[model samples]
Target: MRPKITFFDTKPYDKEIYKPLAEKMGFDVRFVFYHLTEDNILLAQDADVVVIFVNDILNEKVINKLHSYGVKLIALRCAGFNNVDIKAAKDKIKVVRVPAYSPSAIAEHTVALMLSLNRKIHRAYFRTRDANFSLNGLMGYNLNGKTAGVIGTGKIGKSLIKILKGFEMDVLAYDPFPDNKLAESLGYQYTDLDTLFQKSDVISLNCPLTRETKWLIDKDAIDMMKEGVMIINTGRGKLIKTTDLIEGLKAGKVSAAGLDVYEEENEFFFEDLSDQVLEDDVLARLLTFNNVIVTSHQAFFTKEAFMNIANTTLNNIKDFCEGKELKNEVKI
Candidate 1:
């Protein structure tokens, strides 16, 4: 019998992509519209593998429930694994993820957010739609001589650095495990967080969400930054404290912000909330700012990234079924 796989938190696009991929891989697949939750854990009772996305909550209870149901593997389609409790699933189930489906997809989106925020493209487009061709308050600074501070020098960060360098911007990066060789070749410097914040004209968050990195851009950090600095985030949401960011924006310490993710985004993103009033006060307040640009988490929504996620997830399932070493498995 082919291995049985149940995919949760599935959207129409997910089914459109994964169904054919599963057929090619010769696996029995089930797609669940509802996300994996305590109440829906039973849905995967007969499956050999469970596939999930970032929004699924796989805590200790969920892991234990899956173990009881004979589910052997947990495959994540996205890179960030903060949503999963690796320690709880350590001995009970194997967890694997697509660590790098398309770094360029996210990197390019990061740059797009920066450019749009800097040039006031969103405001310009709206004004033109209203038959107002005036260029008032649309002035943007040149990136040619500005310094860009990048947090995290991983694949995505490195890719963004290359783009920033192309614009002749001086780049400063910070990573616990800095790749000095790469820095030397790319013409960027690795510096401490304080120095980066104090000197950079624009700061981009591209790091993972860890205990140390949670709320990395807090009030104190914001106070250290240059006045009228531009802030961009394409990484995990909690990497920045939403309340602190709002304070910075209100005080004019941060001139503008381009955010692709929100700390509480799991509640609003990937769904249509237009018909409903936003109950989240913080998010509603963010929309009121003309200098802020917020996009639903879509940095990795490109066709290339989606295809790579589908292929890698199927391959991960295949490897497990064949008793091969799970190279992408997360170690607790």
Candidate 2:
């Protein structure tokens, strides 16, 4: 019998991409529109593998239930695993993820957000739609000579640095594991967080959400930044504290913000909520700011990235079924 795989939190795009691939890969795949939560944990009762996205709640209880139901593998389609309880699933069930699908997809989206925020594209587009062609309040700074500070020197960060360099911006990066050679080759500097925060005209968060990096951009960090600095986040949302960011925007310490993720976005994103009133006070308040741009976590939604995710994920399950070493397995 083919290995049984149950995919949760599936959208139309996910089904469009994965269903055809599953047939080619010879796996018995099932797609569920609902997310994998504590209440829906038993949905994967008869499956050998459980596939999930970022929004799925895979805490200790959920993982324990999956284990009890004979689910051997927990596969994540996205790179971030902060939502999963890796420690709890350590011995009971193996976890794997597509560490990277397309670094350029996210890297390009990061630059897109920066350019949109800097050039006031969103505001200008809306103004033009209203038949107003005036350029008032649309002033934008040149990125050619300005400094860009990038957090995290991973694949996506490196890709972003290349693009920033192409725009002739002086780049400063901060990471615990620094690559001096890459920085030198790319004509960028790797500096301490304080120095990067103080000097950068535009700051971009491209790091993972870890214990040390959670709320990395709180009040104190904002205070260290340059006045009227542009902030862009394409990484994990909790990397910044929403309340602190609001305070910064109100005080004019941060001139603009572009967010592709939110700390409390699991309940809101990936769904059509246009008809419903937004009950999230912080999110509603954020929309009131003209200088802020909040996207529904679509930085990695490119076709190339989705294809890579589908291919890698199915192959990961295939390798497990064939008793091969799980190269993408998450180690606790």
Candidate 3:
């Protein structure tokens, strides 16, 4: 019999792609839009496997509950698995992830956010729609001569560096295990976090979310940044401090912000909350800024990325059920 898999936090698009993919892979997929919580842990009671997303809470309690019900594996569709308590799942509930579904899909969207924020394209389009063609406060700086700081030089970061280089921007990257061969070929300079922050005209975050990376861009880090800097985050949200970013934006220390993720995104993103009054104060304030561009964490929402995610998720489940060694198991 095919293993029963409970999929949590599924959107319509996710359902559209994964339903067919799961069928093709012969998975007994049970869809649940509810986030994984103590109350909903029973939802996976009958399933042999559980598939989760970023917003789902899979803590010790949840894992133990699932284990009690004889769940064997936890498969993650996204690259980052910070949401899952890997230590708790270790030895008991096996964990795996789709490490690289489509790096370029996210990389291209990172550049898209950077462009839209820097050039005020979203604002310009809205103004033009209303027939207001004035150039007041719409000036944008050229990217050609600017320096771009890349936090992580992984697949997505490497892809982003190539795009920035195409615009002739000097690239500075920081990674504990820097890919010297890739940097040598791509002409990217490796630098410390302080130097990258102080000199970069544009900074893009492409790193994973871990204990070391949480709140990487805090108040003091922002203080070290050059004034009028543009910051973009296409990676994990908690990497940036929401309040600190807001403070920087207000002080003109940060010229613009293009975020595809948010620190308090659990309550707001992946759903339409336009009609309701937003209870999240920081997100509400971000909407008021013309220089800030928030895109509902859609950096990985492209067709190519979705397809790759679907395939990888199905394969992860397949590999686990087949008693094969899980490929992308997290150390912690």
27-115 per-residue lDDT for model 1 (tens digits): 99999988899997889999999999988989999999999999999999999999999999999999999999888999999999899
Candidate 1 global Cα RMSD: 0.8
Worst 10-residue lDDT window, candidate 1: 264-273
Off by over 4 Å in 2: none
Q: For candidate 2, what is the TM-score? A: 0.99
Q: Which pairs of residues have clashing backbones in candidate 2?
A: none
What TM-score number comes out for model 1?
0.99
Model 3 ranges with Cα > 4 A deviation: none
Computed on alpha carbons, the lDDT of every model, listed in order, comes to: 0.94, 0.95, 0.89
| Model 3: residue 45 alpha-carbon error in angstroms | 1.2
**Tens-place lDDT digits, model 3, residues 253-290:** 99999999998897778888779999988889998998
For each candidate in turn, give its C-alpha RMSD to the true structure in angstroms. 0.8, 0.7, 1.1
* Cα misplacement distance, residue 149 of candidate 2 (Å): 0.3
- Select the stronger candidate by TM-score from 1 and 3: 1
- Return the clash pairs for model 3, or none: none
Clashes of each: 0, 0, 0
